[model samples]
Target: MNYLLIENDKCVGVCDYEPNVGNDNIQVITYSGNIPQERLIYVDGKVADMNNYTFINGKYVKKTKAIENLLNTNDEAKHYLNDTDWLVIRHRDQLALGQTTSLTNEQYLDLLTKRQAARERVVEYGE
Candidate 1:
């Protein structure tokens, strides 16, 4: 059986066996033949399901991580901008030299448009 080492009503960590008695705050809850994942709440001597739940006022409540998702989207947008920045620079360099770019004008314009949109998303969604 795996042991969940709880401290101050929170599952601080897991242990393979009951630890040597010392700290009173470190309570041990036994899991019968199962290993629970992190962020699972132990309430009323039972483990809650693996979901976006938070312990509030001695109970678990479902929560949505919208800001986290928005931040992730912003990060993805920033990455896209970084990945395609060279293409925009190359287009400008070729334009200044009056040389034919590898990409057509339409393609270059599309790239610019997409890059602008990515920047907008980063500004709107990022921290």
Candidate 2:
């Protein structure tokens, strides 16, 4: 399945690959450019191309269903200082869903800009 990279504002390849966790059920995943499999984020369920990737701060873990909502939001991009922070605290007892690396705010903004340009081009061409 294809997933949207909210940070990069581009189409990223995604798959339902499982971690070494032996869960038997496939976890939906998002694969961004050069982002190692171990470093990508996995949330339960699937997302359409319209959904977005977000960086959430360390504050919202215990809030039930917060992660799901974060992924589905339109304009807001949540973030944590480091990717590991979310993994460690959120997925501690559970099997490691996947791996992720830190993406700086500047890097993320650049991605959005690119996405906007691409959108503009599509509109111009009437695609």
Candidate 3:
């Protein structure tokens, strides 16, 4: 079982072993599942992702993503780059074969522009 190390109302971290420390501000909760890095652990052992929700008045409330938190945004950019890389490769291979590629020059340029923008965003908000 995984244990959530909750300090105050926030889930500070997770541990596999049971915590035996004596502190009024610290609490632990156990569950049988994969706990994400940023998650909220309720007193009843319910867990919620911090990215999509916020704890308020002892309940989890839905909220919009904060712009300052760019880790997820950077990851999304990287994913976009990786997922569309095959299109570029295919375009190159078709050109080498002296055949008409499925992707037009305009389409290829658009993809390149979008990929460049994604890369720039990742750099601007680096991990």
Candidate 4:
């Protein structure tokens, strides 16, 4: 299975390893080359400790609850928008004219939350 090599709360790289077959120690192959088991913390991707790290797509990302929540909420909001009539010309016209759009309360809340989260990210990242 794939694993993440962590040292000092930073991801060193990714590697493959099997635990407890014949040896307690396993060599982790990284971009820099093979790293000894004693020099890194190996986190198995199968049972991830989400409090520390998260495996996203094909890479390991550090787990930050606030960022995760923001991303999840944004994805949900985008999905809802895509699945609804929000993309229709009539809806755009209504929004442009300051008329009541077809947005549901939940959708509006999700958008609001996403906006707040984005602002927070901008402030945090100073970009």
Candidate that scores best on TM-score: 1
Residue 23, model 4: Cα distance from true site in angstroms = 20
lDDT of 4 by residue, 31-70 (tens): 4444444424345523234355554555556668875786
Prediction-by-prediction clash tally: 0, 9, 0, 0
Better TM-score candidate (3, 4): 3
Which portions of model 1 miss their true places by more than 4 Å?
1-64, 124-127
| Per-prediction TM-score to the true structure, in the order listed | 0.47, 0.19, 0.46, 0.29
Output candidate 1 Cα RMSD: 7.2
lDDT per residue for candidate 2 within 1-127, as digits (tens), equals 3333322322244444533424433433454445443334333332322323433442112233655554434222222223334433553334355544344446555655655554443311111
User: How many angstroms is residue 127 displaced in model 1 relative to the true structure, after the best TM-score fit?
Assistant: 9.9
Name the 10 consecutive residues with the lowest summed lDDT in model 3. Answer: 37-46
lDDT of 2 at 124: 16
Q: Between 2 and 3, whose lDDT is larger?
A: 3
For model 1, how does the per-residue alpha-carbon lDDT over 24-103 read when each residue is reduced to its tens digit? 76777888755555665566677665465644445555556864566577889999999998998998999899998978
RMSD of each: 7.2, 22.0, 9.7, 11.1
Q: How far is 11's C-alpha from truth in model 3 (Å)? A: 16
Error of 2 at 71 (Å): 31
